[model samples]
Target: MKRQIIASINHNLGRAIALLDVIDSKTYQDTSIGPYYSSIGSHIRHTLDFFDCIISGLDTNDIDLTARKRDEVISTDKDAAKDHIYKIQETLTSYTDVNTDYLIHVTDNMGQGKITVNYTLESILAHANSHAIHHYATIGYMLEQLGVSIKIPGFGYNPTTPVNKREGI
Candidate 1:
Protein backbone atom coordinates (compact mmCIF):
# COMPACT_ATOMS: atom_id res chain seq x y z
CA MET A 1 0.00 0.00 0.00
CA LYS A 2 2.79 2.42 0.88
CA ARG A 3 4.64 1.66 -2.32
CA GLN A 4 1.53 2.22 -4.39
CA ILE A 5 0.89 5.53 -2.64
CA ILE A 6 4.45 6.64 -3.28
CA ALA A 7 4.20 5.71 -6.95
CA SER A 8 1.01 7.69 -7.32
CA ILE A 9 2.58 10.71 -5.62
CA ASN A 10 5.45 10.57 -8.09
CA HIS A 11 3.07 10.53 -11.02
CA ASN A 12 0.97 13.42 -9.75
CA LEU A 13 3.97 15.52 -8.86
CA GLY A 14 5.30 14.87 -12.36
CA ARG A 15 2.11 16.22 -13.89
CA ALA A 16 2.25 19.31 -11.71
CA ILE A 17 5.87 19.90 -12.61
CA ALA A 18 4.94 19.64 -16.27
CA LEU A 19 2.11 22.10 -15.84
CA LEU A 20 4.43 24.45 -13.97
CA ASP A 21 6.81 24.36 -16.89
CA VAL A 22 4.23 26.33 -18.83
CA ILE A 23 3.98 29.04 -16.20
CA ASP A 24 6.02 32.10 -17.04
CA SER A 25 8.25 33.07 -14.13
CA LYS A 26 6.80 36.51 -14.69
CA THR A 27 3.33 35.11 -14.22
CA TYR A 28 4.52 33.59 -10.99
CA GLN A 29 5.58 37.03 -9.83
CA ASP A 30 2.14 38.40 -10.55
CA THR A 31 0.16 39.18 -7.41
CA SER A 32 -3.29 37.75 -6.86
CA ILE A 33 -6.09 40.31 -7.10
CA GLY A 34 -6.95 40.45 -3.41
CA PRO A 35 -5.01 38.50 -0.81
CA TYR A 36 -2.01 38.63 1.49
CA TYR A 37 1.02 36.59 0.60
CA SER A 38 -1.14 35.12 -2.14
CA SER A 39 0.76 35.72 -5.33
CA ILE A 40 1.40 32.90 -7.76
CA GLY A 41 5.08 33.00 -6.97
CA SER A 42 4.65 32.73 -3.21
CA HIS A 43 1.91 30.19 -3.60
CA ILE A 44 4.37 27.94 -5.41
CA ARG A 45 7.07 28.76 -2.93
CA HIS A 46 4.83 28.02 0.03
CA THR A 47 3.73 24.68 -1.35
CA LEU A 48 7.35 23.71 -1.66
CA ASP A 49 8.05 25.00 1.83
CA PHE A 50 5.32 22.97 3.44
CA PHE A 51 6.11 19.77 1.58
CA ASP A 52 9.78 20.12 2.30
CA CYS A 53 8.88 20.37 5.96
CA ILE A 54 7.16 16.99 5.92
CA ILE A 55 9.79 15.37 3.71
CA SER A 56 12.48 16.51 6.14
CA GLY A 57 10.90 14.22 8.69
CA LEU A 58 10.88 11.47 6.10
CA ASP A 59 14.68 11.96 6.06
CA THR A 60 14.88 11.00 2.42
CA ASN A 61 16.12 14.43 1.38
CA ASP A 62 16.21 17.87 2.85
CA ILE A 63 14.18 20.17 0.61
CA ASP A 64 13.96 23.66 2.08
CA LEU A 65 11.51 25.90 0.20
CA THR A 66 10.82 28.68 2.64
CA ALA A 67 10.97 32.18 1.16
CA ARG A 68 10.81 35.56 2.84
CA LYS A 69 7.26 36.45 3.76
CA ARG A 70 7.73 39.95 2.36
CA ASP A 71 9.12 38.78 -0.95
CA GLU A 72 6.55 37.15 -3.20
CA VAL A 73 8.82 36.74 -6.20
CA ILE A 74 8.78 33.19 -7.49
CA SER A 75 12.37 32.12 -7.40
CA THR A 76 13.78 34.27 -10.19
CA ASP A 77 14.74 30.85 -11.47
CA LYS A 78 11.69 28.63 -11.89
CA ASP A 79 13.85 25.62 -12.63
CA ALA A 80 15.21 25.72 -9.10
CA ALA A 81 11.71 25.42 -7.71
CA LYS A 82 10.92 22.61 -10.14
CA ASP A 83 14.18 20.89 -9.33
CA HIS A 84 13.56 21.08 -5.60
CA ILE A 85 10.03 19.81 -5.97
CA TYR A 86 11.32 17.01 -8.15
CA LYS A 87 13.89 16.08 -5.54
CA ILE A 88 11.24 15.98 -2.86
CA GLN A 89 9.21 13.48 -4.86
CA GLU A 90 12.29 11.45 -5.66
CA THR A 91 13.45 11.26 -2.08
CA LEU A 92 9.99 10.27 -0.93
CA THR A 93 9.89 7.37 -3.35
CA SER A 94 13.37 6.31 -2.30
CA TYR A 95 12.43 6.49 1.37
CA THR A 96 9.38 4.34 0.82
CA ASP A 97 11.22 2.01 -1.53
CA VAL A 98 12.24 -0.44 1.18
CA ASN A 99 9.60 0.05 3.81
CA THR A 100 6.39 -1.80 3.15
CA ASP A 101 5.16 -2.12 6.71
CA TYR A 102 6.63 0.79 8.64
CA LEU A 103 4.58 3.51 10.22
CA ILE A 104 5.48 6.31 12.65
CA HIS A 105 3.01 8.36 14.63
CA VAL A 106 3.03 12.15 14.73
CA THR A 107 0.62 14.68 16.14
CA ASP A 108 -1.50 16.49 13.62
CA ASN A 109 -0.40 20.09 13.86
CA MET A 110 -3.69 21.50 12.64
CA GLY A 111 -6.26 18.76 12.56
CA GLN A 112 -8.39 17.24 15.28
CA GLY A 113 -6.29 14.16 16.08
CA LYS A 114 -2.92 12.47 15.96
CA ILE A 115 -1.89 10.43 12.91
CA THR A 116 0.99 8.44 11.59
CA VAL A 117 3.89 9.96 9.64
CA ASN A 118 2.95 7.79 6.69
CA TYR A 119 -0.54 9.19 6.88
CA THR A 120 0.86 12.67 7.36
CA LEU A 121 2.80 12.24 4.15
CA GLU A 122 -0.38 11.53 2.25
CA SER A 123 -2.16 14.42 3.90
CA ILE A 124 0.70 16.75 3.10
CA LEU A 125 0.62 15.64 -0.51
CA ALA A 126 -3.05 16.47 -0.67
CA HIS A 127 -2.35 19.85 0.83
CA ALA A 128 0.38 20.52 -1.68
CA ASN A 129 -1.89 19.55 -4.56
CA SER A 130 -4.63 21.76 -3.19
CA HIS A 131 -2.19 24.64 -2.93
CA ALA A 132 -1.22 24.11 -6.54
CA ILE A 133 -4.85 24.09 -7.61
CA HIS A 134 -5.54 27.28 -5.73
CA HIS A 135 -2.57 28.98 -7.33
CA TYR A 136 -3.50 27.63 -10.75
CA ALA A 137 -7.08 28.74 -10.37
CA THR A 138 -6.06 32.14 -9.17
CA ILE A 139 -3.57 32.43 -12.01
CA GLY A 140 -6.31 31.42 -14.45
CA TYR A 141 -8.54 34.16 -13.15
CA MET A 142 -5.68 36.60 -13.19
CA LEU A 143 -4.89 35.68 -16.77
CA GLU A 144 -8.50 35.99 -17.83
CA GLN A 145 -8.71 39.34 -16.13
CA LEU A 146 -5.72 40.32 -18.22
CA GLY A 147 -7.51 38.96 -21.32
CA VAL A 148 -5.13 36.08 -21.90
CA SER A 149 -6.30 32.48 -22.33
CA ILE A 150 -4.76 29.73 -20.22
CA LYS A 151 -2.00 28.08 -22.19
CA ILE A 152 -1.93 24.93 -20.10
CA PRO A 153 -3.92 22.06 -21.65
CA GLY A 154 -5.25 20.33 -18.52
CA PHE A 155 -6.50 23.39 -16.67
CA GLY A 156 -10.04 22.64 -17.70
CA TYR A 157 -10.05 18.98 -16.68
CA ASN A 158 -11.47 19.88 -13.29
CA PRO A 159 -13.13 23.07 -12.12
CA THR A 160 -12.03 21.99 -8.66
CA THR A 161 -9.80 19.00 -7.94
CA PRO A 162 -10.66 17.06 -4.80
CA VAL A 163 -9.54 13.65 -5.99
CA ASN A 164 -6.00 14.53 -7.08
CA LYS A 165 -4.86 10.92 -7.52
CA ARG A 166 -1.39 9.83 -8.60
CA GLU A 167 0.03 12.86 -6.82
CA GLY A 168 1.43 12.69 -3.31
CA ILE A 169 -1.98 13.20 -1.79
Candidate 2:
Protein backbone atom coordinates (compact mmCIF):
# COMPACT_ATOMS: atom_id res chain seq x y z
CA MET A 1 0.00 0.00 0.00
CA LYS A 2 2.84 2.40 0.83
CA ARG A 3 4.57 1.58 -2.41
CA GLN A 4 1.40 2.11 -4.39
CA ILE A 5 0.70 5.47 -2.77
CA ILE A 6 4.23 6.71 -3.30
CA ALA A 7 4.21 5.52 -6.92
CA SER A 8 0.95 7.31 -7.67
CA ILE A 9 2.26 10.61 -6.26
CA ASN A 10 5.60 10.30 -8.06
CA HIS A 11 3.79 9.54 -11.31
CA ASN A 12 1.70 12.71 -11.06
CA LEU A 13 4.73 14.80 -10.06
CA GLY A 14 6.54 13.38 -13.07
CA ARG A 15 3.72 14.59 -15.28
CA ALA A 16 4.11 18.07 -13.79
CA ILE A 17 7.84 17.98 -14.48
CA ALA A 18 7.22 16.84 -18.04
CA LEU A 19 4.82 19.70 -18.66
CA LEU A 20 7.23 22.17 -17.09
CA ASP A 21 9.99 20.98 -19.38
CA VAL A 22 7.89 21.74 -22.45
CA ILE A 23 6.30 25.02 -21.41
CA ASP A 24 8.21 28.29 -21.49
CA SER A 25 8.45 30.63 -18.48
CA LYS A 26 5.82 32.93 -19.95
CA THR A 27 3.19 30.21 -20.08
CA TYR A 28 4.07 28.95 -16.64
CA GLN A 29 3.78 32.33 -14.91
CA ASP A 30 0.97 33.74 -17.04
CA THR A 31 -2.10 34.63 -14.95
CA SER A 32 -4.03 36.03 -17.91
CA ILE A 33 -6.12 32.90 -18.34
CA GLY A 34 -9.52 32.28 -16.80
CA PRO A 35 -11.85 34.18 -14.45
CA TYR A 36 -9.69 33.38 -11.46
CA TYR A 37 -6.51 34.32 -13.31
CA SER A 38 -4.31 31.85 -11.45
CA SER A 39 -1.07 30.83 -13.13
CA ILE A 40 0.08 27.27 -13.78
CA GLY A 41 3.10 27.87 -11.59
CA SER A 42 0.83 29.00 -8.73
CA HIS A 43 -1.12 25.76 -8.92
CA ILE A 44 2.10 23.77 -8.97
CA ARG A 45 3.40 25.58 -5.91
CA HIS A 46 0.12 25.22 -4.05
CA THR A 47 -0.04 21.48 -4.68
CA LEU A 48 3.54 21.02 -3.58
CA ASP A 49 2.85 23.08 -0.45
CA PHE A 50 0.54 20.38 0.85
CA PHE A 51 3.27 17.80 0.45
CA ASP A 52 5.76 20.12 2.08
CA CYS A 53 3.55 20.44 5.12
CA ILE A 54 3.25 16.68 5.40
CA ILE A 55 6.98 16.20 5.09
CA SER A 56 7.76 18.87 7.66
CA GLY A 57 5.25 17.53 10.17
CA LEU A 58 6.24 13.89 9.81
CA ASP A 59 8.76 13.93 12.64
CA THR A 60 6.41 15.77 14.99
CA ASN A 61 3.26 13.86 13.96
CA ASP A 62 1.38 17.18 13.83
CA ILE A 63 0.61 18.44 10.34
CA ASP A 64 -0.56 21.99 9.81
CA LEU A 65 -2.21 22.54 6.47
CA THR A 66 -2.18 26.32 6.68
CA ALA A 67 1.56 26.53 7.17
CA ARG A 68 2.41 26.92 3.50
CA LYS A 69 5.55 28.61 2.25
CA ARG A 70 3.85 30.18 -0.78
CA ASP A 71 7.26 31.16 -2.06
CA GLU A 72 7.21 33.68 -4.91
CA VAL A 73 9.95 31.92 -6.81
CA ILE A 74 8.09 28.62 -6.61
CA SER A 75 4.98 30.29 -7.96
CA THR A 76 6.71 31.98 -10.88
CA ASP A 77 9.72 29.87 -11.82
CA LYS A 78 9.42 26.41 -13.43
CA ASP A 79 12.92 25.39 -12.37
CA ALA A 80 12.18 26.25 -8.75
CA ALA A 81 8.93 24.32 -8.88
CA LYS A 82 10.76 21.34 -10.35
CA ASP A 83 13.36 21.56 -7.62
CA HIS A 84 10.66 21.57 -4.94
CA ILE A 85 8.97 18.60 -6.55
CA TYR A 86 12.26 16.72 -6.69
CA LYS A 87 12.84 17.36 -2.99
CA ILE A 88 9.36 16.07 -2.19
CA GLN A 89 10.00 12.94 -4.27
CA GLU A 90 13.24 12.36 -2.44
CA THR A 91 11.54 12.67 0.96
CA LEU A 92 8.77 10.32 -0.13
CA THR A 93 11.36 7.78 -1.23
CA SER A 94 12.81 7.74 2.29
CA TYR A 95 9.41 6.83 3.75
CA THR A 96 9.62 3.29 2.40
CA ASP A 97 10.49 1.96 5.81
CA VAL A 98 7.94 3.99 7.77
CA ASN A 99 4.73 2.39 9.01
CA THR A 100 1.75 3.57 7.00
CA ASP A 101 -0.73 2.90 9.81
CA TYR A 102 0.92 5.31 12.20
CA LEU A 103 -1.53 7.87 13.56
CA ILE A 104 -0.95 11.59 13.10
CA HIS A 105 -2.78 14.80 13.95
CA VAL A 106 -3.78 17.07 11.07
CA THR A 107 -5.07 20.62 11.38
CA ASP A 108 -6.97 22.41 8.63
CA ASN A 109 -9.72 24.97 8.27
CA MET A 110 -12.73 23.81 6.26
CA GLY A 111 -14.37 27.21 5.56
CA GLN A 112 -15.12 27.44 9.23
CA GLY A 113 -12.86 27.37 12.23
CA LYS A 114 -9.60 25.45 12.30
CA ILE A 115 -9.93 21.90 13.51
CA THR A 116 -7.55 19.14 14.36
CA VAL A 117 -8.27 15.51 13.55
CA ASN A 118 -6.57 12.18 13.73
CA TYR A 119 -5.46 10.52 10.52
CA THR A 120 -3.28 7.61 9.61
CA LEU A 121 -0.14 8.46 7.68
CA GLU A 122 -1.40 6.54 4.67
CA SER A 123 -4.78 8.27 4.75
CA ILE A 124 -3.25 11.78 4.78
CA LEU A 125 -0.86 10.86 1.99
CA ALA A 126 -3.76 9.57 -0.06
CA HIS A 127 -5.72 12.76 0.59
CA ALA A 128 -2.74 14.87 -0.47
CA ASN A 129 -2.51 12.85 -3.71
CA SER A 130 -6.17 13.46 -4.46
CA HIS A 131 -5.74 17.15 -3.62
CA ALA A 132 -2.83 17.39 -6.04
CA ILE A 133 -4.91 15.82 -8.79
CA HIS A 134 -7.74 18.27 -8.20
CA HIS A 135 -5.37 21.22 -8.56
CA TYR A 136 -3.84 19.58 -11.65
CA ALA A 137 -7.25 19.59 -13.30
CA THR A 138 -7.45 23.34 -12.73
CA ILE A 139 -3.94 23.67 -14.16
CA GLY A 140 -5.13 21.71 -17.20
CA TYR A 141 -7.86 24.26 -17.79
CA MET A 142 -5.32 27.07 -17.54
CA LEU A 143 -3.01 25.29 -19.97
CA GLU A 144 -5.81 24.82 -22.46
CA GLN A 145 -6.74 28.47 -22.24
CA LEU A 146 -3.10 29.45 -22.78
CA GLY A 147 -2.91 27.21 -25.91
CA VAL A 148 -0.24 25.05 -24.35
CA SER A 149 -0.37 21.41 -25.42
CA ILE A 150 0.93 18.85 -22.95
CA LYS A 151 1.70 15.29 -24.02
CA ILE A 152 1.42 13.65 -20.63
CA PRO A 153 -1.49 11.19 -20.66
CA GLY A 154 -4.04 11.44 -17.81
CA PHE A 155 -2.10 14.43 -16.58
CA GLY A 156 -4.73 15.89 -14.28
CA TYR A 157 -7.25 13.04 -14.00
CA ASN A 158 -8.06 10.78 -11.10
CA PRO A 159 -7.31 7.14 -11.78
CA THR A 160 -10.98 6.15 -11.31
CA THR A 161 -12.32 8.84 -13.69
CA PRO A 162 -13.28 7.59 -17.12
CA VAL A 163 -10.96 8.82 -19.89
CA ASN A 164 -13.86 9.39 -22.28
CA LYS A 165 -15.62 11.71 -19.83
CA ARG A 166 -12.42 13.57 -19.04
CA GLU A 167 -11.61 14.09 -22.75
CA GLY A 168 -15.21 14.79 -23.84
CA ILE A 169 -14.81 11.90 -26.26
Candidate 3:
Protein backbone atom coordinates (compact mmCIF):
# COMPACT_ATOMS: atom_id res chain seq x y z
CA MET A 1 0.00 0.00 0.00
CA LYS A 2 2.80 2.43 0.84
CA ARG A 3 4.53 1.66 -2.41
CA GLN A 4 1.31 2.18 -4.38
CA ILE A 5 0.62 5.50 -2.67
CA ILE A 6 4.14 6.76 -3.28
CA ALA A 7 3.92 5.67 -6.90
CA SER A 8 0.73 7.63 -7.42
CA ILE A 9 2.26 10.78 -5.96
CA ASN A 10 5.38 10.41 -8.08
CA HIS A 11 3.29 9.73 -11.19
CA ASN A 12 1.32 12.97 -10.83
CA LEU A 13 4.44 14.95 -10.02
CA GLY A 14 6.08 13.54 -13.12
CA ARG A 15 3.15 14.78 -15.20
CA ALA A 16 3.60 18.25 -13.74
CA ILE A 17 7.24 18.20 -14.73
CA ALA A 18 6.32 16.97 -18.20
CA LEU A 19 3.78 19.75 -18.54
CA LEU A 20 6.42 22.34 -17.74
CA ASP A 21 8.71 20.77 -20.28
CA VAL A 22 6.17 20.85 -23.10
CA ILE A 23 4.52 24.25 -22.60
CA ASP A 24 6.22 27.59 -23.02
CA SER A 25 6.32 30.05 -20.11
CA LYS A 26 3.74 32.28 -21.82
CA THR A 27 1.26 29.43 -22.15
CA TYR A 28 1.93 28.24 -18.63
CA GLN A 29 1.11 31.63 -17.08
CA ASP A 30 -1.61 32.69 -19.53
CA THR A 31 -5.04 33.53 -18.12
CA SER A 32 -6.94 34.59 -21.24
CA ILE A 33 -9.45 31.78 -20.99
CA GLY A 34 -13.00 32.54 -19.99
CA PRO A 35 -14.89 31.35 -16.89
CA TYR A 36 -12.53 30.29 -14.13
CA TYR A 37 -9.69 31.90 -16.03
CA SER A 38 -6.99 30.03 -14.16
CA SER A 39 -3.67 29.26 -15.88
CA ILE A 40 -1.91 25.91 -16.02
CA GLY A 41 0.77 27.35 -13.78
CA SER A 42 -1.83 28.23 -11.19
CA HIS A 43 -3.16 24.68 -11.12
CA ILE A 44 0.33 23.23 -10.91
CA ARG A 45 1.30 25.59 -8.10
CA HIS A 46 -1.84 24.84 -6.15
CA THR A 47 -1.32 21.08 -6.47
CA LEU A 48 2.29 21.32 -5.37
CA ASP A 49 1.48 23.64 -2.49
CA PHE A 50 -0.81 21.02 -0.96
CA PHE A 51 1.90 18.42 -1.16
CA ASP A 52 4.42 20.88 0.26
CA CYS A 53 2.22 21.56 3.24
CA ILE A 54 1.86 17.86 3.98
CA ILE A 55 5.55 17.11 3.61
CA SER A 56 6.74 20.10 5.60
CA GLY A 57 4.44 19.25 8.46
CA LEU A 58 5.23 15.55 8.64
CA ASP A 59 7.95 15.89 11.26
CA THR A 60 5.90 18.29 13.37
CA ASN A 61 2.73 16.25 12.85
CA ASP A 62 0.77 19.47 12.29
CA ILE A 63 -0.27 19.53 8.65
CA ASP A 64 -1.77 22.97 8.26
CA LEU A 65 -3.32 23.48 4.84
CA THR A 66 -4.21 27.06 5.74
CA ALA A 67 -0.58 27.94 6.18
CA ARG A 68 0.53 27.03 2.68
CA LYS A 69 3.69 28.76 1.45
CA ARG A 70 1.78 29.69 -1.74
CA ASP A 71 4.96 30.62 -3.57
CA GLU A 72 4.21 33.19 -6.30
CA VAL A 73 7.32 32.32 -8.29
CA ILE A 74 5.94 28.83 -8.71
CA SER A 75 2.69 30.24 -10.10
CA THR A 76 4.38 32.42 -12.70
CA ASP A 77 7.61 30.64 -13.57
CA LYS A 78 7.73 27.24 -15.23
CA ASP A 79 11.33 26.62 -14.23
CA ALA A 80 10.63 27.42 -10.60
CA ALA A 81 7.57 25.20 -10.64
CA LYS A 82 9.57 22.36 -12.13
CA ASP A 83 12.27 22.85 -9.52
CA HIS A 84 9.69 22.67 -6.77
CA ILE A 85 8.14 19.60 -8.35
CA TYR A 86 11.48 17.84 -8.35
CA LYS A 87 12.00 18.74 -4.71
CA ILE A 88 8.60 17.29 -3.86
CA GLN A 89 9.41 14.15 -5.82
CA GLU A 90 12.59 13.74 -3.83
CA THR A 91 10.74 14.34 -0.57
CA LEU A 92 8.11 11.74 -1.38
CA THR A 93 10.80 9.22 -2.18
CA SER A 94 12.43 9.80 1.20
CA TYR A 95 9.19 8.96 3.01
CA THR A 96 9.20 5.29 2.10
CA ASP A 97 9.74 4.38 5.75
CA VAL A 98 7.09 6.74 7.15
CA ASN A 99 4.66 5.31 9.64
CA THR A 100 1.39 5.68 7.80
CA ASP A 101 -0.58 4.53 10.82
CA TYR A 102 0.59 7.45 12.93
CA LEU A 103 -2.20 9.96 13.49
CA ILE A 104 -1.67 13.62 12.71
CA HIS A 105 -3.73 16.83 12.71
CA VAL A 106 -4.69 18.66 9.54
CA THR A 107 -5.88 22.22 9.92
CA ASP A 108 -7.93 23.85 7.18
CA ASN A 109 -10.73 26.32 6.63
CA MET A 110 -14.21 24.80 6.34
CA GLY A 111 -16.61 27.68 5.66
CA GLN A 112 -17.42 28.38 9.30
CA GLY A 113 -13.79 28.80 10.25
CA LYS A 114 -10.58 26.91 10.83
CA ILE A 115 -10.80 23.33 11.94
CA THR A 116 -8.24 20.73 12.86
CA VAL A 117 -9.09 17.12 12.23
CA ASN A 118 -7.18 14.00 13.17
CA TYR A 119 -6.00 11.98 10.21
CA THR A 120 -3.45 9.34 9.50
CA LEU A 121 -0.49 10.29 7.37
CA GLU A 122 -1.65 7.68 4.89
CA SER A 123 -5.07 9.28 4.47
CA ILE A 124 -3.67 12.78 4.01
CA LEU A 125 -1.18 11.58 1.42
CA ALA A 126 -4.00 9.85 -0.45
CA HIS A 127 -6.04 13.06 -0.45
CA ALA A 128 -3.05 14.99 -1.80
CA ASN A 129 -2.70 12.50 -4.67
CA SER A 130 -6.37 12.82 -5.61
CA HIS A 131 -6.22 16.61 -5.37
CA ALA A 132 -3.30 16.71 -7.81
CA ILE A 133 -5.25 14.67 -10.37
CA HIS A 134 -8.28 16.96 -10.04
CA HIS A 135 -6.16 20.05 -10.67
CA TYR A 136 -4.44 18.27 -13.57
CA ALA A 137 -7.81 17.75 -15.23
CA THR A 138 -8.45 21.48 -15.04
CA ILE A 139 -5.00 22.07 -16.51
CA GLY A 140 -5.92 19.68 -19.32
CA TYR A 141 -8.97 21.78 -20.10
CA MET A 142 -6.84 24.91 -20.16
CA LEU A 143 -4.39 23.20 -22.49
CA GLU A 144 -7.24 22.30 -24.81
CA GLN A 145 -8.37 25.93 -24.92
CA LEU A 146 -4.81 27.01 -25.70
CA GLY A 147 -4.53 24.26 -28.40
CA VAL A 148 -1.37 22.81 -26.85
CA SER A 149 -1.33 19.06 -27.26
CA ILE A 150 0.71 17.32 -24.54
CA LYS A 151 1.90 13.79 -25.27
CA ILE A 152 2.26 12.73 -21.65
CA PRO A 153 -0.20 9.98 -20.85
CA GLY A 154 -2.41 10.00 -17.71
CA PHE A 155 -1.78 13.63 -16.94
CA GLY A 156 -5.30 14.20 -15.68
CA TYR A 157 -6.70 10.72 -15.05
CA ASN A 158 -8.06 9.57 -11.72
CA PRO A 159 -6.56 6.35 -10.46
CA THR A 160 -10.00 4.84 -10.15
CA THR A 161 -10.55 5.38 -13.89
CA PRO A 162 -10.68 2.08 -15.70
CA VAL A 163 -7.43 1.05 -17.35
CA ASN A 164 -9.13 0.72 -20.74
CA LYS A 165 -10.48 4.28 -20.51
CA ARG A 166 -7.11 5.97 -20.01
CA GLU A 167 -5.26 7.44 -22.97
CA GLY A 168 -2.59 5.25 -24.61
CA ILE A 169 -4.04 2.31 -22.75
Q: lDDT values of the candidates?
A: 0.54, 0.87, 0.85
- Ranking the candidates on lDDT from highest down gives 2, 3, 1
Which parts of model 1 are misplaced by more than 4 Å?
60-75, 100-102, 107-135, 151-169
Best-matching candidate per TM-score? 2
Model 1 superposed RMSD (Cα)? 6.1
Per-residue lDDT tens digits for candidate 3, residues 1-169, read 8777887888878888887887899999999887988788888889998999998888898999988887889999999998998898888888887666778999999989999999887789899999988888888888888888877787788867897877620
**Candidate 2 lDDT, tens digit per residue, 1-169?**
8878898888888888988998899989899986988888999999999999999998898899989889989999899999989999999988977776667999999889889999987889899999988988888888877777776788788888886765510
Worst window of 10 by summed lDDT in candidate 1: 62-71
The residue ranges of model 2 lying beyond 4 angstroms of the native Cα positions read 166-169
Q: Order of candidates by TM-score, top first?
A: 2, 3, 1
Better by lDDT, candidate 2 or 1? 2
Q: Quick one: RMSD of model 2?
A: 1.8
TM-score of 2: 0.94
Which lDDT tens digits does candidate 1 get at residues 24-58?
Answer: 76665666456453455565666566656666545
